[model samples]
Target: TKIKNEFPVFKNKVDGKKLIYFDNACTVLKPKSVIEAMNNYYQNLGVCSGDRSSHLLSWRVQELVEQAREKVREFINASSTKEIIWTKNTTEGINLIASSFPFKKPRDEVVLTLLEHHSNLLPFYEQGKRRGFKIRIIVPNKDGSLDLNLFKKIITDKTALVAVTHLSNVTGLIYPIKKIISLAHQKGAKVLVDDAQYIATHREDVQKNQMDFMVFSGHKIGGPTGIGVLYGRESLLNNLFSYNVGGGTVQSVKIHGNNIKVQYLPPPAGFEAGIQDYAGIIGLKAAVNFLEKQNQEEIADYIEKLSHYAFEQLKKIPEIKFLADYQNQIPATLISFYFSDKKVSLYDFNLFLNHELKDYFVAVRCGHHCAQPLHQFFNTSISMRASFFIYNSTKEIDILIQALKDFFNRKK
Candidate 1:
């Protein structure tokens, strides 16, 4: 309850009713501290950083940006700050890797899973198309759990990289990333984890996990948008080609009569091409600070409990069929379900709850959730998801349950 007060969005109401924000998987509500941090940057130190200017504001901005990078490195237990590369979001980070990674045609291969969000899947897919590297998609078990045996069989010496989501955005199931990393390592393959969902509630140690690379969005963890972190092994980052290179990426340029040669900076500087999102970086640092203050283990436990409660409550409704078995030991941060009646439109139901419902405004996501392959695997066109976070409670789940019951009963 006290934590809910920290989020300013809780103060607002929709149609004279309290907002039940169950779309946390899309983005979490920002706290006052994070907002203030961004404002402080704009109000005081709004200047170009990183060799652009030699003024007080620029110096301050540079200092704070590095501070944020260091904080992210520490947050993810990365080996060094050099491993952290700033991007617009997780998609850009993945795209950078896809573009820069050295994939040898006819010999190199990329492996991905069905649990991936579109961000993790598309870049590699497009890259594969261009590079002619073999691309393999690993299918998950019925419960959205990774079939490790399948992975072992699929990943061979030819596999260059194994990219997977640490947590499924649609299913909210946390995958066994460490095991996956170990398996991929055994096959001489590098592993990349999309930690966009996991980073918010779980503790991720890139060093401990031995993952080659990891990416997550700032806004998913109560930070500002347009800022994300891509963590890589320092050695690997230095070796890869910089995808988006410009002013900030290069250290020096030499001009031959007709050809120009450029010397690029190492790791982070080279990877971050343009002027960085100084305010977003500052807000992200504040968010990391906020997360540091909170008991993450407790928050995770709370979210799991709330998810289980929501699952049990939703299961009572005869019209609903859950995408994954929630009763399992695997903890969930969200629950997705489709109506038993195939004729009923998922979008209409979502619209009913989001707009037409008078008792409460429930913000649930309805669609493929950017995981079309996962939906195809499940043989469903679309499903409704109610995701939760630290600010959510059993009371909110109760409201959601009642709203769903009212919607279905009225339809009957």
Candidate 2:
């Protein structure tokens, strides 16, 4: 496919074999367009922007940064560019909300799920401790699907914020975000969605979802690392305190007696402190443009088919057991499973697979996948994961199955 060729990483070799990367959940390979865009920015008009200077180069840089913000605002269907805050990644975006969102009472609550990545979990946990707020965690069903009934019972009037992942990175299970958002709103609670995994392949309409806030990493969507987006309701953002205070975030400063007065800029600028990642931001805009050309729904459907084929092939092996049932959960972009025999550790099996499939360049992820709570719920420490993306093919799944079969046969 032409899309596959767009990524120059495919041309590279690993250990004398073509590179086959299946770790889309962690990060995606950058397309040439994204790389060129970043390189072009660095090569030309690379200068500090925003209030720092009035030079022609500085103005060009400022224009590029603002243009990137508009692209991200349109990408997620946010109301205005003012609501778009530049963050280092999904983790920092969530941290910004956790630290800055107004929690009035001591008993105010923050709700989350067991399926969250550490990035989504840690910030809330740390902030809740300091702010004297209670955190309620909802456990998913045995099938790894969220229980809406339980979720409804947990979010009460006292719940100030509901932080949830739009999709489970480990299980590839999509959450009912629109319903969750509606329920949270009914209880007067704001919703913050961690869309790190979902935004890469799915079209997230923040206005349609009625989301108060959303976060996603650029690296996961064919963009450069060190660039991410945070979408917040403009009203909510304006009321909240800035997470970081420094240079460009402030409009003016005054000194009188022992106290100093500072005037801060509105929303986006207020939250983004110091010099931003100009090149990475530009590359993210390029990535968004590249992805918009391809229909997100079509890409999702294609990945789901690949997941279904992989699941069926893996199910043929009696020793294999899935973390969740894939039949009921259609359109999964990934699958997590482990050998039931328990003779081989997940790490050992991953090493074996990597060695055996070096020629075919089959690569997969094997670990707790940064969701320890979810693994604990299943009573499993770790498992193997094969994630599918737009560039992946059914032929790759076939090769993976054959490799697994060969490994099992050799073990016997």
Candidate 3:
């Protein structure tokens, strides 16, 4: 596809081999549109404090942030643009909710899953430590798939929130999110989906799924790093107090005695604490526009087909073992296998391969892909990962396979 050509990285050669980058799960390559959009922001209007200025250039930058919020609102089918809050990244978004949002003392349980990334897990841990709340964890199966039965048992009347990933980055397994949300709601617990790995890749419509909240990273969706989205239900957000307040986010500030009585602005504004990333926000909106034009479904399907083919081809290597044989289902890029035997670490063998197979590209990974808790359920040691995206094709996978087999033969 011309998509591969659009990325300059593919055209660049390494050791006489065209660079074969299969690490889409880590962070996707931004397209020309996202690049051009950010460049234009700097070239045309590189103004600081967009909201504070009355100049037209400053107003343009201000509109960019708002437009990005609106675009994300549309992306997730949020009820109102005001419900979409800008964050540094998904980790920050999760932290924002944990640190800022107020919860009743009696209803303080935070439910997370074994498949959660560290970004989604640690904030809850810290929050639990501070709030003196019990953090309940849902265990996944040996193959890294979640057990919804366990989830039903955990979320109770005392549960304040249920935060889970929409897809497993380790196993490429899609969770039963709609059912999870329904169960959480029945228990009067709010649901927050960490869509960092799935958002633009999975085509998630939060409103259609009746999702109460959602979060995702911009870098994963072909935008710049350091930008994220926090989508909250309009009603739910209005009731919750802002964790951070500054600049135009507050309507009026008043000092009464030693305490402060501030008339906080509504969400979107109220949630945007401190100075915003105007250029990054503009790039994020451009990224959304890029996804919209290509059609999210088309991009998803194309990437899925490539990932499925990679899975099939990679399974042919005798030395490799799969965590789960889920080529027919799952929407994630690709995740499977490690280089070591029972006695050895996958990191060691994969490192040898990466060094020895310098003549060709064999995209592989080791270590828990940040889902360390889930790793206990499936992998005894870290597994190798080679993920694909819309820009990837069969030719690239073929190169990776040959390089891998050659290294294995040399080692033996």
Worst 10 residues of 3 by lDDT: 324-333
Q: What is the C-alpha lDDT of each candidate?
A: 0.88, 0.88, 0.79
Clash pairs, candidate 2, are none
Instruction: Identify the runs in model 3 with alpha carbons over 4 angstroms from their true place.
Output: 325-331, 340-345, 348-363
The 10-residue segment with the lowest total lDDT in model 2:
324-333
For model 3, state the Cα shift of residue 143 in Å. 2.8
* Model 2 accuracy (lDDT, Cα): 0.88
- Candidate 3 C-alpha lDDT tens digits along 197-264: 78767788888888887899998888999988888888888877667778868888888889988887
List where candidate 2 sits over 4 angstroms from the true fold. Answer: none
Clashing pairs in 1: none
Listed in order, each prediction's TM-score against the native is 0.97, 0.97, 0.93
Tens-place lDDT digits, model 1, residues 306-400: 98898879879999987866545444788889998998778888888778767678888889899988988888978898899988889989888
